[model samples]
Target: MKLSHLLPALIWLMAGSLCAAPPHSDVRIASPWPAQNTILAMLGYGENIVGTSMVAKKIPLFRQSLPRIDSVPVVSVNSGHELNPEQIISLGTQILFVPSSMTVPQQDLLRQAGVRVLAFDANSLQALTSRVQKTADALGPDAQDKAQRYQHYFDRNVALVKERLKGLPQDQRITLYHSMGNPLTTTGRPSLNQDWMDLAGAKNVAENWFAGKQNRRGEVALEQVVAANPAVIVAMNKRDADAIQTTSQWAQVDAVVHHRVYVNPKGMFWWCRETSEEALQFLWLAKTLYPDRFADVDMRQETRRFYQDFFAITLSDAQISDVLNPPQ
Candidate 1:
């Protein structure tokens, strides 16, 4: 063949290949964020996961729902900020997802090794929904439709809660205290934790407890909690709820006195956190706060349907209970 003729043919072929290829097709992704891992699986990208973090693997829902999860290697200890690009590249990873905390240099290391890097920030509801859509986009066309459906479900429920609580007076809003891992540590100030309370038509006593990005502890003295005296307490677990109930200092708190200490559900990856399951958390809180208003909403049935609809996993009653209480 003539050199000129062969060169033109090759150029045309290369152009066609580039033009026809789907964005992120044949993607092999690894993520250190447990919240992201749960969302990825929910969006039907579980099969593409070649690596994940240890925290994601420990989630009961992942063990039960995603078989590929067991085969995926753990790339980092907690977050993927210090991920080894050589290790990830060797695994044939096309994409690596790190949290917003991941440094630019770390992401650049993977990028230089021919891997795309994506960052997820899941501090707010807006951030969570954006993560869902962006993740679906990265998974190619097949997952886009599923992301849309989930978004619709999320928007519908958010609207329902807003409509139900549209005219709720300030006095009617329940005062809430949400504790995290420890008794004093709560998701204070602006975050999805505070958003949950707002969506549920409740007042958060810890909303202004600790303010600033530098303050990661989110802890307030026990006395401040007693002074606020929340009407309801949403503990990280049943154990925390019990601590508030039985502890002498907490006895005077209104929530403790009224027996309104409820344990937050720990699902795919702590529904209370930035996981896609935050949709359920908002609903659960709405009902928990105003039982009379949301009497028709049953969380157990919603949970079963959510897993079946999104991840195609059917849960037995016992399995559902396991995630809700999640054995101590």
Candidate 2:
């Protein structure tokens, strides 16, 4: 069977603007967004990616499912912080996907060379929906339908989590801390970090600092974190979560004492970020924050379902563990 047959989200995201496309074999692309690469693969355009980014090239799950991922040249470094516009043009990349905040020094150069650079803001849930569409649009009609289906699945799961939490007391929202990249670095402003935390019915402590004036991924002092006294804490890496759990300074923190510090699940990319996996992130976070409220939600089963449904990949129990725990 064709790899396309194995990936059905393609049909779901490819439904709009059937203004047609080149032969499926001809749609070459490059992008600094790691999540965008995973989504393109889901739409059955994996082979067309000739230029990729450093982070996308390193995702373990992405490599396992799409071995060809290893063959794509890394044309952009960290969302174009260091991009090779000449290399992208040389690779014949038709579309380049990036965040609106892109800072590459040669963006004008890419346009001059006839590369269509598409930028979108994916800082919030509302914007994420549009981002997926914008990405799919470049892939042409087939990806548009897949984006719609993914959106429906995402929204439905959000509603399910919301409905399930309705029985909990209004005052039960957990006071939480979410660490990004490192143990103390966390969400600031204009990030989906707040969106999922809010969806999971938790109060993110960082949102209150500097009146929400921090960068999307900013650092907070250990003293500041202690003062927040969050009931739960989540870190982007297992080592950080372990630090919160075992370090002396963090020992007095409520989450550490209560054993609530957790390693965020990461698949194609950290689920806590803009990846399609945020659908599962909200469910997992809600369950972690209030196990009683989500007693019936089996995260293992949910993880298996998400990978199978959206990415068309079947995972072993060990693979599921890797996604949830992620290696240090």
Candidate 3:
């Protein structure tokens, strides 16, 4: 064959091979939700993130987990109600991950700008695991393996907790009241926070009280909380826990009176949320509720292992403690 004829064929073959190659390596992603951002970072796609919301910026561990996170542009829209489509387009984002709560118009705007948008509901354990899988699927084939491993770890941890707490009498289950921030703001039935309480082998005092309500969080009068008199009082952070402890009105509440007030751990994301760290949150909550049953579970070691295995980061003793017990 002539050299000129062979050269054209070779060039065509090269172009075909390049087109067949996967595009995941070049994917530029943006997420306005902190939970989804944490999941993506855990899946080893932190380097692909081109934009983030204000909420993601506030997470110290999230920032620490991704060395290049600061370089990502902030694209929060209307004080977090939506995402900034213009900034996202400007950053060359190929994909945008959002919570299911995002409005249709917000999604439309991004799609019109040529960005593929994925919305996942991470409100329940099932939804959260499914979202993880979906997010991984969007990333590429390599991420599927990570997602499966994560799901297995999550299921195994949950099963371990369940097996250990099997046949626990309902009466013995610790009843907990979750203080959102103030004593009045609390979590109830149908909420992810309540799901955490249930998985931890504890009862939510506000479960039936807010039945049929659309919102997950509601304000319960202080009188009602004192009347319920839960065995444990769980707060999202130390500030709320301290408020519950110091408030004179709650002095007589059983949880406060017995010094059973506890704070949920906060890290890259709130452990209490239905994020990738839910398995750890379940273990922590279970341990806090029934110390005798979970005495063998070293949370510090578990935290270190989860980060190392999933996020590929090794946390120090102090870092683990900070995650398990955040400052006020």
The candidate 2 region of ten consecutive residues with least summed lDDT is 10-19
Which stretches of candidate 1 lie above 4 Å from their native place?
1-25, 77-81, 104-108, 213-217
- For model 1, residues 1-328, the per-residue Cα lDDT tens digits are 5543443444444345445443554677888788888888888888788988788888777877886688789875425456665566556567777778765444554554456788877678898899899988878777888899999999989998998898899998999988888878887657888887888898998777667654334768999999999999988877888889999999999999989888888878888897888888889899888988898988889999998998899989998887666664
Clashing pairs in 1: none
lDDT string for model 2 (1-328, tens) is 5533532333233322223645645877888788777777766677788887678788888888888878888875654376666566666666887777776556665555556788788778788777777777777777887888888888888998899788667577889999877887888555788989888988888885645464556777999999989999888898888778878998898998888888899998888887778788999998888888889889999999888987889999999999988876
2 or 3, greater by lDDT: 3
Q: What's the ranking of the predictions by TM-score, best on top?
A: 3, 1, 2
Using TM-score as the yardstick, the better of models 1 and 3 is: 3
Candidate that scores best on lDDT: 3
* Number of colliding residue pairs in each model: 0, 14, 0
lDDT of 2: 0.78
Residue 140's lDDT in candidate 2: 71
| Alpha-carbon RMSD of each model | 6.9, 7.9, 7.8
Model 1, TM vs. native: 0.88
The most accurate candidate by TM-score is: 3
What is the overall TM-score of model 3 with all chains considered together?
Answer: 0.89
